[model samples]
Target: MKNLAWLSLGLMIGQFAYADPIENGISFTSGDWEIVCDNTRTCRAAGYQNEDDGTQQPVSVLLTRAAGKNQAVVGQIRLGATDTDPTDTEVQMKINGQNFGKVSISKDGDFLGHLSSAQVEGILSSVKKTSLIDFIGKQQKWRVSDKGVAAVLLKMDDVQGRINTTGAIVKKGALTEANVLPALPKPLITTVKVKSSPVQWNSTQLSQLRAALKATFKSDDDACSMLTDPQEGASEISITRLNDQKLLTSALCWRAAYNEGYGYWVIDAKAPYHPVLVTTDASDYQEGKITSAQKGRGVGDCWSSESWAWDGKQFIHTGASTTGECKAVAAGGTWNLPTFVSTVR
Candidate 1:
């Protein structure tokens, strides 16, 4: 974290457009340029030119009067080289010269992290360069290059060039088809909080279980897409066929053990017996992992969710280890479900 001077040269330029008091001038000895606005609210500076391709690019820095006397410094801050490219650009925000976090546009032009923010000031800095060009391009090169704001801004002209070459198609001049596929189904959570011993469910838990089953069924084809196979698959709920046609409607319910984006399937099932819980892991051929969790209370099971990750081998259940375990095997991501409705006649 480089501590910027309260009166950096770049801050002046940002203030130039907002407040009208900015004045541009040359640095006498540093040979760097500066912009000062409103006498005190904003200030900016550029670094001495570097000789790369005989191009002396400016490294712009800016500072603004922040919430208190503490000033907010922002603009392009160079970190180092990428695997191939020599320079990587990051949008830096600081308070009173101390570093806050940054959002770096990798050498590959990928925006990494709106990362951790120490305060609101950091958030503001992120918004400033959400779509900056040079800050994004320099990292794509296979060698060292200047990653200054001016350089990036210059490169943005290339992006504009591409857009112009493609030529924008007016919607009114084009015939577009409507989106017919349904939206992704919403997640359903169980409401029962069953505790130790004789467990039972309430309307909330039953409703949640119904919704969860619906989502699971709907997710069948979608989940199957995650598998290696190309065909539709079957999924099932397991319960013992206890009595001879003794009307049994057991719903599955269990607390999730992992989080989202991990390999897990959230299920809501329950049986007539006490201590009924359901938890499972899911994966597809494409998007690897997804996990789901649910917990029950004393005779009142309330399912909650947690997440976990997978490494193509086994599921890394996040949080801590649990006694409850359920698995949702994926075949092209479609559930290879076991028998669902098995009862004695």
Candidate 2:
């Protein structure tokens, strides 16, 4: 999964001041407005705003047009992390102070609404003339600039194959009405039974384990430091047998200075002399599989986790989940489980 560390509203928005220029797909920029085509060829235009005190607001507006005929022209308004119930409120859009429409909030806490082709054209035309768009929620407002929107949409059409080299043009049309939004699959829940008893290692065994760990970190200076001088009271080492006679040992070193940690050395019982260091930070191994997680904090906290199975030679990522909403503070939270990405078997 792509790292969701950027989901931290404050940290992410702050970095946007120095964000890199777009390199892939079609990209157009004017003033504070930016439009770009994604890998899927879908085009979206977005604008950001910061408060007078330099504090970043998580509010933004996205205008998207998908490829193909009759594709929906969507307007999306995203807000900062909040525990407020979005379903109880409404979001409105205005072009040049003229009311466009009102929309409901999505499960992701954003307001998304499909627009008619006529509405799209009107908004585009108004932006060119007035160069201002406003998105108003119950208690917040976002002002967007439309300076370069016209050129962006035209280029987007060309990239999406809507424009032919023969100077032909495809007109935008109304989208089909749909009542239900697509739903993401639920995460897999498995309760693997692990051994309740802990293993006791003798002095000779401990020495061998240390030797294995040393060999694993010999070429990694950072890893070596983490293993040797980990943060005070934030280190652990353990040995366990996954199967009848296959013992595995692992270690965790927390480095508070980095707000991160490291785990390494998955030694096989039969090959103790040639231990393999885990390339991925996975832990809680059981039944030939291990789980790993990454998290970030700011105005809201976000996390992504995955489970991988060891197939004798390598670990294969099998399942994954992520917290999509920053304010979803329930146990395990609301996870969006998309199809698993490929992993070497």
CA RMSD per model (angstroms):
22.0, 10.4
TM-score of each: 0.20, 0.53
| Candidate 1 Cα errors over 4 Å, as ranges | 1-76, 80-224, 227-263, 269-345
> Global lDDT of each model?
0.27, 0.50
Q: Write the per-residue lDDT of candidate 2 for residues 1-345, one digit (tens) a residue.
A: 112321332242344335332222344554455565543455576544433324333344566765555466665555543344334255676777778776555664443344445545556566434455665776665555554455455455455545432221222334331321222232233343434234668777777676667666545455545555444442456777654544556666544432454564555565364776664355466666677666644423455566666555545456654443333222333333222433333
Instruction: Name the lDDT of candidate 2.
Output: 0.50
lDDT, candidate 1, equals 0.27
Top lDDT prediction, candidate number: 2
For candidate 1, write residues 1-345 as lDDT tens digits. Answer: 122522342353333334232121111112222222221112232222233434222222222221112123343332223123234455544443445554554455322223332433342333223222122233232111222433222112121121122221101113222321111221222222112122245766654543444444344343322221224232223222212221112232221333222122322234322221122332211122233432333321123343333332232333221211111111111111111111111
What's model 1's TM-score?
0.20
- Residue 322 in candidate 2, Cα distance off native in Å: 8.0
Instruction: Specify the poorest-scoring 10-residue window by lDDT in model 1.
Output: 327-336
